[model samples]
Target: MGLRIPVKLKHNDKEVEVNALLNTGFETDEPVVALPLTIASQLNLTPGEKRFYLGPGALVGEVYLAGEVTITVKVGESERSIKAYAVIEPREEEIILSDRAIAELGIVVDLKHMKWWLV
Candidate 1:
């Protein structure tokens, strides 16, 4: 039901690889990504601010903005990196790629064929 991309996150010299789903509905002013609390713990990320997350349907709750995180992804033949805010959701098990993040990464998603490529 969504586009998934490989994501590499680095924080405090700790690096981990995970798959993030591209969420077109996620509208944010900054380029950000949402990570599970467990994964954030692995990166030793620090919380910044409290925010509310609205999920599919009526699911809505509070989440912590887990400071700054480095997101690295390969675009075309080159690798790109950007700093993004990480929202830590204790109950979330999947990584979400926000629209801002997608713009920064230059990822092109083909919804008609259900595929994605780096531009």
Candidate 2:
């Protein structure tokens, strides 16, 4: 279920880092991560889990946690990291790099024209 991206969350103020796996299949798909409510509240997340609305009356709840961290991802000769929410998919137990990791590893996504861009 955690078939998405891997993000690294770093907090300069807290001096801590949390590498999290992100999945877009969550019900709410709010770009939030999987974490307890107690932790989520501290990050100023919504009340309880988020509710997702699909159809006219379809609704589903999602699990999310809020934590301040930075997302490190390598692009070229230098390393690139972005400030983002380190979210995970609930019911997902392990963390692994999806196709997204290839990008961070300095591999080209467009193999046709950009095959020589690997660094």
Best by TM-score: 1
1-119 per-residue lDDT for model 1 (tens digits): 87788889988889899988998788888998888988898899866688887778998888898888899987567788889988897777998988999888877888789888777
lDDT of 1 at 99: 92
Write candidate 2's Cα lDDT for 26-100 as tens digits. Answer: 333223335444333334444433443343356544534344344455435556553444343354454333334
CA deviation > 4 Å runs, candidate 1:
53-59
TM-score of 2: 0.38
**Off by more than 4 A, model 2:** 1-7, 12-61, 94-119
lDDT of each: 0.85, 0.39
TM-score list, all predictions:
0.88, 0.38
lDDT of 1: 0.85
Q: After superposition on all CA atoms, how large is the RMSD of candidate 2?
A: 7.5
